[model samples]
Target: MNTQPTHRPVALCALIFAFLITTAAADKPTNVVLILSDDQAWTDYGFMGHPDIKTPHLDQLARESAVFRRGYVPTALCRPSLVTLLTGHYASTHGVTGNDPSPKYAPRDSEVYNQRRAKLISYLDRFETVPEALGKLGYLSHQSGKLWEGSYQNCGFTHGMTRGFPEKGGRHGDDGLKIGREGMQPINEFLDLVKEEDKPFFIWYAPFLPHTPHNPPQRLMDKYSSPDRPITVAKYYAMCDWFDETCGQLLGMIDDKGMRDNTLVVYVTDNGWIQDPKKNGYAPRSKQTPYEGGIRTPIMYRLPGKIKPTERTELVSSIDIVPTILAAAGASIPRDLPGLNLMPNLTSGDPIERDTIYGESFAHDIADVDDPEASLLFRWAIQGNYKLLLTYDGEVNRYQSTHPRTEKRPQLFDLIADPTEQTNIAAEHPDIVKRLANKINAWYPVKKRKVLTTFQ
Candidate 1:
């Protein structure tokens, strides 16, 4: 009887301690899932005022989330865009200016050596990413599909489901399965794997639909047959629907694991679609250009503890994402980050004051095409509604009477008045044009390489 009493007291104490530990863990750990869509146009989604795109899952997610109406990306293309998103740095610093010039596609060993001098530079893996930073805080980090600028795995992801899109000998095709097949596999697997584990986890899902090939499932492809819309519009709509289906599937898994309330679900696009001017009837420039259609993206925040179901028009860029995620999880924002923690805007009911947003790019055609090295310099800066595009098409020698060909280009736009970017108001608002030009020149130093231009 004496021995039994001693054992009972010890058992009660152990049980009490176990309960306290579990409660503490639950309070601190919060799962974060960032779903990144590839090159999706703003108007392609039904929620964003699209005429006829079936995005039920996206619509449902947005209905219960805070939407950022004026979200933008730092660059128009993939490699630079993803780098800026992870590091919160602009292209000039990150150095991933163009697509991956994979050596596998080199015509010959000598060709690789010859092209090395002119090869586009990519961002190194040393720059810390949100996932890696979260891992430092003892959070499990996992990513699938389109992780970073290059194959170097220094971004600090604990696990990767997919390396990226399926590339077979540099051949390009319209296979939807090839695009998102691997990136999504881990998302589905994690949904099931997390049923027992209560530890906080971070997962990134980048779907490759609606990007280029425009190849969606046949079932979704059958939904749109409007001849009035662009021929590619039907295919584009199909990709959007298919992407939404994946979102629904991921959400279902969250619900099944009973992690919806404790998880933060963020939906955003890598960049806007490469719209064709003749068909899209919206913008003149495509993805490789510094236009709103290429840079402006959609951002959806879904966290009951943080976000209110409302739309905010304040301009926010991709660089702000890392800080925002850290803030959401009660983690500290790193001192080196250029972005501000957005959790206050989401949770405190106070609006964030942002008057200016910046976007930049180097010539994209350099790597893929036989373009002149002199034309590879370009940049832009936007403040409020004013925008200035600076194109550096080689240097102009006074003796040769050479100058930038696009110097004849126009600037200045009242985004509120002409959101479509149709008319050039630079001549009418010379003051605004000069002001914007001066700001751009002040913000970015003029580069005098093989080419250079300063609009101011």
Candidate 2:
């Protein structure tokens, strides 16, 4: 009899119900599936005007998403570039300039390298990463492949494939490299868990597909094989298609789960790779060089009901991924992050925040993350259609040991008119070169400072 008469209990029940509803809504902002292809060129996809290679799934995804055809990364190598994507900071800021170590420390020889590597991976903890940011806001995340930053837990993922134990024969993504290459069971299981838990999730699908060891199933390879195209080229093309097929399956799962309306799909490459024309290897200028083929990539964001699908030519950077994902999930972005949130541009065709984007091309051997110019090979700036590449060839340039094919002079390219960068107009237009050089210097100061071997 007193159950209906108790007014306080009824009001408390209402408040509790409202709290539950709010918490439930907070856990369902927008699921993010960031698919990163390793060592793929900007022009490799059918949508990006690749004449031979077929990336039908990616092509369709491009059509359905807001595509940035001229997106660029901070570095041309995988480790540094992927770091920028996760942390929303440049290689200069993050202090992870190279793939592994400078020739000084062998990984297994001494704990010196292991200690250094641990220090490098720990730098990720300094900044709030995309997954870490989303994880704070009730999002479960799974790291699938190509992650170099120690462990999945170190980066704040709820669950991941990489243990990242240096003592236990773990270098970088030891068993995690087999996501798309082997199977999708791990990803599928994670999705099922997320479904059962009723929470938003971030999926890092950075598969090491088409990177190296150009091995593909014969069934896929036969599709591109021909007398005109070299077998290497055919195999590379098949690998691209194989990667595309995996993407199709992943996307299909999203649709089947009825999560398309709420899920956000993002696509970008860690760096670019161009298979050599003659030999079965990578071309010099395509990867690890300060060229469009190395640094340029297509940035795509797809949310069915949130963002409209369209192509954008305005320049953007891989660094923007962190801020964009944070903003989408209603999370806080760190103030020092150099990247702009592309939410306005994603929802509407808003103008980009900045006019120019600057980057560095460092040697594979990182002299010091604290010093950009120490291991620096080239300093580049892109403002509008004009891009300037300043190559360092003296004592400062560590890459000189490898005999870089890049010219030892400042080169300028009007990307709109000379997208291929065949002709250098640096001498023809000295004023433009001077202006761009000054702009780059202003963006990233080139003054010398004290050297430190640790991350700043």
Candidate 3:
């Protein structure tokens, strides 16, 4: 009896060891994966009540994520919109208001065009990107698809596939475009390296699927095509299905690697698209305009055991993504970011405090590389249920023939009453229009922009 160890001391030692183990687990860094859709309409997903399109994987993701049905990007174009996500700033603030520099420097073979393109890519140097900020915490980032800001290295990615602009055929994605379309080899290889190193990882998976050249697998084409639906529409629909399948594969890989619990996955689209029924191109008032069909998307955040799945109707912007990811990784957020940290909103189900959100649309080609306001087309504001779209005089550039803006006046719509924006109540609701217009101007005062109507 005297030789036996005391039971109380052994029990106390076991409790202390268990506490240390739990603390270490809690302190482990989280992995991040950002899935960006190329050109998808806000209404095209199965979870969004689409009658025909079957996005089963995205539907499952919606169920598991904190889904914001009324999410939007500040600009409706691809390059500038993607830049906004990277910098956590509006297109106005970041000085990347358009996809390409002014068409005046065009022909694609000129030295002036190359110089301007190089200048456009240089804009990323000024702002601190998500990958750059995460690197301070010993995290590794990989850039895979749809990179416009030069190479992955330029964007603070440890590993990437984009050769970057100034390289031949390196304008948008170059070799990086093959991530989802060709295969997921690059992503899998990067994941393998991350596992070997045992480090936290960040992946930018912006595939060029369903954007254009709507070529889907034969099986998917057979499923979506029908006599009632045009071949053009069917092709677009099948592309959506294919995009969803790729997403499922990516997510399934994470689950297979046993990284789902420690991964924070976010989903959004670069911009919106409405496929033409008669043609293969995008229809008017979509992709490059300030309409709901152009700017709206379903933003989602999923972190197993951390973020509770809930649908939020309050307006959220892609700008909030960077700050949210930063907060989730326990990194210090930059004070200059205009968006809110959505950690509380995601984890505790707290409603976003701000009621008013602002957006600015610009020409496809930059009128002035130094001045973001030079290419301004529309500066819109959504306050409560009323949305006000104030048009500005600017060149439509490349999209002039395909998607022209004919409205030259302030258009106001009660989104709750008429979601499709069929009727304009600007004349009837002068008070509301003036209020929203002032709010928009105050948010981003453009001295050179020519306002079609005076709010005062």
Per residue, candidate 3 scores C-alpha lDDT tens digits across 362-445 of 998897788777788898999888999998877666777634556677899998898889998888888888889889878867
Query: Which residue pairs show collisions in model 3?
Result: none
TM-score of each: 0.80, 0.89, 0.96
Rank ordering of all candidates by TM-score, starting from the highest: 3, 2, 1
Q: Which ten residues in a row have the lowest lDDT in candidate 3?
A: 396-405
Over 4 Å off, model 3: 1-14, 454-456
lDDT string for model 1 (1-456, tens) is 455435778899999999998787567667898888887876678788887888989899989888887788877777677767677677666566555443333543355633542343223454677777787777776665564332314456676543322222221122222425434556666665655455678877765666656666677767875667666677777877888888887888787777888788887787777555256422336465566777777787888755788887777777788888888777778787766677788777687776677766655423432332333445566677766665655322221111224544545567767776777677777776666666666766655533222223
The segments of candidate 2 whose C-alpha lies over 4 angstroms from its true place after superposition are 1-27, 105-108, 393-406, 449-456
Worst 10 residues of 2 by lDDT: 447-456
lDDT of 2 by residue, 1-456 (tens): 456556888899999999998777556688999999988889899998989889889999999999999899889988888889888888878888887666453543367766677878888888888888898889999998888898888888999998775647576677898888998989998888999998899999988787777899999988999999988888889888889999999998888887787888999998888888687778767788778888999999998866888988789888888889888888888888888889878888776778888888777776654465667677788989899888764223344533363466678899999998988888887877888888877777666532211111
The clash numbers for all candidates, in the given order, read: 0, 0, 0
Instruction: Name the top lDDT candidate.
Output: 3
What's model 1's lDDT at 119? 42
Error of 3 at 287 (Å): 0.6
